[model samples]
Target chain A: MSDALPGSLVGPVEIVGAGLIGTSIALACRRAGLEVLLTDSSDDHLRTASGLGAGRATTPDDRPQLVVVAVPPDHLGAQIARALAGGAVVTDVGSVKVGPLAAVAGVPGVERYVGGHPMAGSERSGPLAASSALFDGRPWAVTPHPGSTPEAVALVEALALLCGAVPVRLTPDEHDLAVARTSHLPHLLAALAAGALADAPADHLALSGQGVRDVTRVAAGDPALYGQIVAANAHAVGALLTGVRERLDAVIEALAGGDRAGVEAVLSEGVSGTRAIPGKHGGPTRPTGTVFVAVPDHPGELARLFADAGASEVNIEDVRIDHDPGRPVGLVELTVDEDRAEHLLTSLESKGWVTHR
Target chain B: MSDALPGSLVGPVEIVGAGLIGTSIALACRRAGLEVLLTDSSDDHLRTASGLGAGRATTPDDRPQLVVVAVPPDHLGAQIARALAGGAVVTDVGSVKVGPLAAVAGVPGVERYVGGHPMAGSERSGPLAASSALFDGRPWAVTPHPGSTPEAVALVEALALLCGAVPVRLTPDEHDLAVARTSHLPHLLAALAAGALADAPADHLALSGQGVRDVTRVAAGDPALYGQIVAANAHAVGALLTGVRERLDAVIEALAGGDRAGVEAVLSEGVSGTRAIPGKHGGPTRPTGTVFVAVPDHPGELARLFADAGASEVNIEDVRIDHDPGRPVGLVELTVDEDRAEHLLTSLESKGWVTHR
Candidate 1:
């Protein structure tokens, strides 16, 4: 097809599951002008994914140079073993790397397999929701054990590159533990915080605003799907969650005892922790100032604001919409480089935009 | 001065503490064509507020019909008492209601006081950060005790209306508990979650995405100010955090013991809880669908997208920008009414947008 994307990939790439990750990988491969073949346990999934031009359905005679097993955690081991037996370099896109790698350990062709997880997804799942660009600009964790060959790891890394993802190297255990802290822990905590609102009074919830919305946004994810994810990485996630629980308990105890220093310690730790998160482009966090402009909830209003910002030549770092409940007005907070924020604010005000400094 | 803003006020309004809230209230009152006077413990603050044309410096001869004590919680009671003794209808814009109201409960002119907390603010605080339009279309909770007269309650409600805020009525205790859930709990949990990132490896933290960012966004708030806010609402906030801790402990226990059902129960509860939060405009949550578009990091890309959507006549409910680490492109997720999502996707595609549906 398209001269097999600039790496170790020499022939068609076979994907053995046509779910969201699998179909997405297929689409990305196809977009790269590489031949792709897809298979799935469900006939409907295969038909749906192929119908969407993800790839043609796989045939028994198809001899792929590389295979991606994009199946659920419980089936990843068997699928990897099967792909390796078929004489293909293999990788799996399961969320948890350690367990899947562990299951495939000591298999006859173990050296041919590397573990990969594209760190991107929406709450929605299935091939219908898949996109070729899903992994673009995302971190695709490439986990290689001692048994994996250099060529095998390179193939997975090549796949990441072709998919427009940056390859992040980590050992299986390290990857799992890192995700436990950054992803799994936050999801569980979000769920915990959101669960507290399940029984709150109707009027009480009417008071909810952007803060609660942001904190609990991920809690709307499918519990069944998340339950499976958490179960696979339970040991690591459990440890992290336990750590958070202890911190939370200390905070409660401090507040209960009116221990101001203890309370301040925990809250200030949060400030420091959030400060550690990389800002735009994976750099260290830098302060940004906001210029809030009152925008009416109508078509072209946001467009006009951004156009005005464009005219001012001040690059917007980020934007947040704080809609006034039951009102036509929203506050569009434009975050710009701290140095440029004042210029942007004054420019917008000069353009007759009512800006809140 | 223009006629009093459809209220009982017959004289100039006096504002104390000249902070962000106080100065903002003064500006709003002045915008409504009412004369105002300002006082603060710090001369710098008084000067800064007056210099912004918020109001004039208060003098002993000033006889104000209404006095707003927009001071810190610790000083709210005394300020309200002082204002009431000066024969002015009094209210305080302290975040917490019960503690301050209790402090001035038996003062001779307590009947003239009503309690208010405007549900709006920026992380920045001071007269420099104040805006006359700050409270426009926001909720301003009005808490009146039995000692409050009808006229006093009307005066405070009228202030809220003049400030362009919707007045929500609740008892002081009811207000405290409600905010403990909506505001206080989310802040604590955000801080705790962000705290987990403090010791993480830089590389590990680099793997974070929008989910972590949203959950911990407010964790960047000034710890000293938040500490004070938390301290004033300690009992209510502590009780709620304890409940969250218990729920989190249950999750940790389930994960540690490999109890799938227990973990599922907690996660499912989180889903239900988040579902309870009102959507935009304070209506019940509705089904929305998203269309993703790849936008390169460039000035006015967002404006272009919104322009296209506007042309398509699809009202966007919300928009989120997911900046890809180390890439020039970001993914823009446009959420819209479910039925309109397809129209938006097709419309963007027609306009040469590579949309991922």
Candidate 2:
């Protein structure tokens, strides 16, 4: 495992939590040839992480060069302060930044702390769910307060790099507000939208399609956890929700009055909004066209189709498979660069695949 | 070609509006051994449909046993009335039901008409986008007013079956309200959620992940067209939106006030709402466990993994591939029945696959 690690990662690092993020970070650090020490308030969590090859218990003689605090938001500030007391370059992996930074502002050795959050996770939690590859290619936010030393910030950025993540730097306030709009608010709205289905007749819900499923997927996450995340960033999330409410009210009123233009404006806004999300690797969102190929529901069929696309020199940007229940065929939609879509369709057709635009 | 079609379909089926749904229906009918007569206001569309082997142009002497009016919502009333005047068992594939039904209630021969909406579509439109397999195993709602004769309703049901779709019967009012909650409301909310991203800073959106993408996927649909669908069902949609707004306000206020319990309620509600959506084949949602297999970023690797899983006697319920940009590997998450997850993981691992929880 250490063979794959970067040479820049220093050993003897201390992780203050053994939860999902903490254990995953430890595993990444361990894979990066760093000596990790795992600790958590619960002995079960600590043992689980240690057994998973994340790290062993810290010894008194092991003076760490870096300390990572990965705890719940409510306890993050205190944990950061505790880690900073060890005189190591301290950082955190909390979801929200500004609140915790402010709470630790007056603590001793505050300059040794840099706030960080990796924008990568799954619905699962706990040490058992940890994986070394969790942070790979993900965006990790590093927010440093003015009182922090440049050395501390650099150390945190280096750690993120060692984990194969792209570190994005922003001020604490900016980071909180940005995440409020991009992450927290979206989660909340997903929950809100999904919550509406609770009382719907079962027969109606049986007709739900991919549209509703995709829209509400994140709402199925743990409620208490999401509540805490939103609560931690309440001010920013609340402000954004207010804006959404105002816009929604207008849409509702327009819809109630049957105003076509008014409804169009709102719907158009959605188009522009979705278009703003960057494509793969943070590139500008490309206009991609889809080629729908009907693939027989067999294991090797999808592989053959993709192989054929690859042979044609068409790069597939994204793929979605729509499997009709009880059917032996699936619609495999391949999203490719718009300019190459026609070529791909013709190529696939010539190869005996049924293609639909 | 006719061998692929069912024998129940009669000859000389008339289809109005050679657009996406209309053209697709024509292709399905032609595949079902029927003599299809295609018509459209736009000559270009008619030609395109004909070029695609949907059907030949209709002549005055070409009488129809069944008539399908797959036109825009606003024009559906007139189109359906005209089709009904031909003395055929007429049906429509409009998105909305009650409004069009009410509009054509006074038309002569209205008793021959039944309102229908096929729960199948794509973002693309026009005759070139038609597919004969578009409706396979999907639900097609058939709504009839009290005046609808049993024979007329049976013909519409037969049409749905011939297209390989399950026909679900509902009163016009019930169909309108059910679709308002299941289809129309979800579409509008997706648009509203996506619209929220329009003014966000570019850098903020650069970090967006699959969560945001899934939530806003439907928002990328044609705005003018969606506006019309929402407008036609404005009354029902407006009422649903109003409820959403009310719940949203409560959640926002709770977040602003740091009311953890209140926020939890909203989040938990989302969990329940999403759970109400039936899984594959309209079955209760199964609790699935995922095993993450790291596959190299190359064609045929996914096929190998699925083949491996199939060999293990595990049926994969769903799959999602998370590709790390510029990385040599992608993580393929396979969801299977909870009981079989551990066995699958071990089997894959023994087969030299890198498995994660």
Candidate 3:
């Protein structure tokens, strides 16, 4: 184990895949003035990534100080094992950590391998969809196995930093369980909710509102890719699903028995759960107020509304646009600091914008 | 039955409740130069609604031409029944239609009663949260029962139009089932998904991303209110929950058995379900491209970005702000017409904004 301190990682950082995540990491490394060696099974992807200034093609003579495996989940273990044989510190950007870590356990250089998963991605894939800022300010879990050296962990953290992400350290098992609750569980729920709509009558679907749109939004993601991701984290996901099924059964029973209190209990739990989520900036949730403004459905309306909002000097925390059918206007909900909501409402109203709380 | 036309609705429009929907309806009617008579069980709500110019206090001798019942679900049936005794064309803005319709089925003036649901509301309740524009450009389901007269239906449809909404006609049963699928089902699913996170450790919650946030957003609604909602449509909601449970079982079974193909099939159905949702303007879904821009987490940054985006003359269909913990920046995703994405990209890039698709 090389006991490298944070920011002590030197080039060349070899990326084993030239897909979206791999190429994006390579671009970020290049931006940090590091030598990135890129390779891929597909010649076209490698050529395109290198041509885009992500990195140069890897040569047989090149010796890498760090190797990042960014291939599909099935290929992760094999790639990590291959990278480990080169005597370089290895890490992977796979979604699940436990399975892959277990795959490479007892390998000759297992001590030099740390697990990482950057919590950022888009529905689009391939090298063309890569961006240097893909992981900017996102959470990147650095999962270290018991046998992993601190130096290997530090290097993985440094790599996350290089990609403009905040590194959160957790054990490989902990990482799996955490993501299972946050990512896999939510995805499955979304898919299940959305699947019910597949054969729905047009009248039922026509009644769809922003709520359904939001719940089903992520369900539109590529299935095959998510299947592998979920299958990799099955143990943790299965446990959570079992818990969810129990709750579902409770809700069903409550509904059937006309048990309002039972239904409300479940709903109250949901409210608390929503509040449990940390607000932006990773702090306790803050109180916010929403200001609704009706804007005409046109190009410059938002710019105008936002400019007016900016003039109020109230920081906008979030924005949601609700567009209804057969309407020439769209409602824009602006979430702001609770104390400033009234001020924003008054400011926009005074500026001739129709506003509501 | 008078056989009235769409524009034949004339006031005095008497509102049975002075809650959010009732007060908003009063305000909308007032905006259209109608004489509104407001009443509420609570003196404070009545005073507030009347003081806000929503309407005048209801008088004993007033013979209203139309009555809108907007009380809580528990009181909706009684209110609608009482209003029908006044020989007025009655409508209730309750979420579930069948229950209220059934409650007034054999009333003397039942033929004059038409069920209505504005399909618009806020998490915030009471008269203070009311707005004249609440129903503007939104869907208003005009659900008529078997014995409903055309005159009553036309009057209700006119009321929807007067409030700046497009009236979507559905049978009372159809309305209930439709909302059960679109609104209630989604809410329950959101709650179920969010409930799993209630007892999650801080570390697990820290891994939360936009997907989980979006899926769980609606779960934060008032428990008692949602309980009433989900309970009112219990039959339909319960049926959907049963269907959802079957899919859940399939997912759990697939995960346990390591059936990749089974998992992929469920996810694929979700994709198709998401695609079936109509786009804005109540048309088939349109292909839209998302342009992501990094904005500083401060006042005026969004304003500046929107200004630059507006300059490109690309009509933004939607906007989402993703804020990460410990980040001084937020990612703004602007959705626009797919064909014009490149134009907007180049235009924004020329203005020194860092953007990605």
Candidate 4:
């Protein structure tokens, strides 16, 4: 048997604090065939996570081979200290690292502690929102303080590896700045949009289209946790905000000058440059083919068409439909792969479905 | 023939102007089975757009039923006057309605002037980048001046409808203010991000992620055109900027107090609000789905795995590969519809792939 801290073997992992980060870690760990030891002060959280099979609740006596402390930033330092003091190879998944690092100062065997953050998430939080594949292909940052032993760092990196995450090495300071600009600042901008809209009449919001939605997608994150993220990384976020402010000022100056073409130019720039960012899975979203299908205006017709298309081995990557009750025409737009596009078209054609390029 | 304009059946719809808006509008119009008449003083622009099939060159003797002027805001009023001098229902797709309307001076047959904007686009300019589906499912604002004729307004509204856009009515003042907050201000903010990054070391840009990209998406727009837009809409855009600036000052002040928790609280609020914005196509982009596949450590193994997945009629929504060169095991994450998810899993399972919830 492998002589690890938690057991004679290390097939399972133990996690403390089953909140969003903790539960997600649990989920990712479980997917990797590791038994998980989950411990949360709140029985409710533990019960919920255990119910989802993230892991069974455990105590230190359970002899967890590996322990992860996924707690609030303020509690992170002490928790890591306690875990290390208990002789477990410990890692804390917290957005803020310095404060926690300082908190654990001079703890015996502190070299066993490693700092980590899986840079993937949604606005939602809690165990119920957990999915086993949360960290499948996201960037995970690992920061080893000057005092951390190479062994501890290796274990943290191994954990990241097991979860299928890319381990990006960074100093604590660098990590904070990077997140402020990339994650926290974007959140603040999104907040501005939503807060502005909160005052709008409901009908206006109901009529809002995809642009508004895209601009405010991150606004729905858990309030307190995001607050922590921002406060911890304010300097980096502030720099980004300052840049944004300058641009705003330039735009305002242009508008004041009655330069109609100027404003159009500014908006068009946003359209092009923003598209460069990668979408899901780090792949830039570029449309390969657009196929328009005419379907009958009948209940269950969409399901039937989809089923028929599936039978013909046509995989629809994305689907959007335009319905006008006042007219006999309905346009269904499908985005698909270049290779399979012709096949999808031919399959639909064979099924007598009216379509166009 | 439908001779609504006697001796005026132009080669197609007469589209004056060949900038981004002009080219995009032409693309949509031509795609919808409409013959197009295109004229731009710049032979280069006309050639580029025509080469890309934005429209066909046409003669004035072929009188067209509709003539669209998609020019700079300052030039809109005069262009509308000239287009209407021919007695065809004419319209201008400009952002600011009041300025252009005032410029028109309520000429004879003033009712023929309907000002419209298909509330969609990008920062990229030029006809070469035009797409027929740019305006699909977007909100198109059709603003009618007091002098606009019912038929003229109706014709423009019909055009917007034909292009598969939702028609929303907004007066000139309301349109200006609403856009200042939504479009104009966001442009400025994105520009600021770009400007700041411009000052950042070039290597830092390599570290850029989606957060920076999303927040600064509009900054890369054609600086010249944007200048025109901002200048024309200054009053509204300026006022919105003032509001944003004031809020930002408050945030800075909070942080200065070292009220870390408080600062974090406010910032998190911003993040929560931003997440509420929908993703592409007005849907939540919170990712779902995961795929587990063991990859060998050999070179090109991971690439081959992805290629195989791509070949199996699956669009890999997102990817995460844990890095461990020695025993490189990759857990690939993919997003798929809930229905086809099982089918995909089974197929992978049949091929001896390992998957877990």
Residue B208 CA error for candidate 4 (Å)? Answer: 6.3
Candidate 1 per-residue lDDT over residues B44-158, each given as its tens digit: 9999999999989999988888899988877888888889888878888988898998899889989889999888888679999999988888888899998888888988898
Better of 1 and 4 by TM-score: 1
Interface RMSD, candidates in the order listed:
1.3, 2.5, 0.9, 8.0
Ranking of predictions according to TM-score: 3, 1, 2, 4
| Ten contiguous residues with the weakest lDDT in model 3 chain A | A1-10
DockQ of each: 0.72, 0.55, 0.81, 0.19
- What lDDT would candidate 2 get against the real structure? 0.82
Q: Which stretches of candidate 1 lie over 4 Å from their true place?
A: A1-7, B1-11
Name the runs in model 3 displaced over 4 angstroms: A1-7, B1-7
The CAPRI category of model 1 is: medium
lDDT (CA) per prediction: 0.85, 0.82, 0.90, 0.64
Candidate 1 lDDT at B300 equals 77
Error of 2 at A209 (Å): 1.4
User: Model 2, range B180-278, lDDT digits (tens) per residue?
Assistant: 887777777777778778998776765576777888888888889989998998888888888888889888878878799999998899999888888
TM-score of each: 0.97, 0.94, 0.98, 0.74
| Interface RMSD against the true structure, candidate 4 | 8.0
TM-score of 3: 0.98
Chain B global fold similarity (TM-score) for predicted model 1 against the true chain B: 0.95
Top-TM-score structure, candidate number: 3
Mind giving the per-residue lDDT tens digits that candidate 2 earns over A56-160? 987666678788999998999888888877778789999999999989989999998999999888667899989887787778889999988877788899999
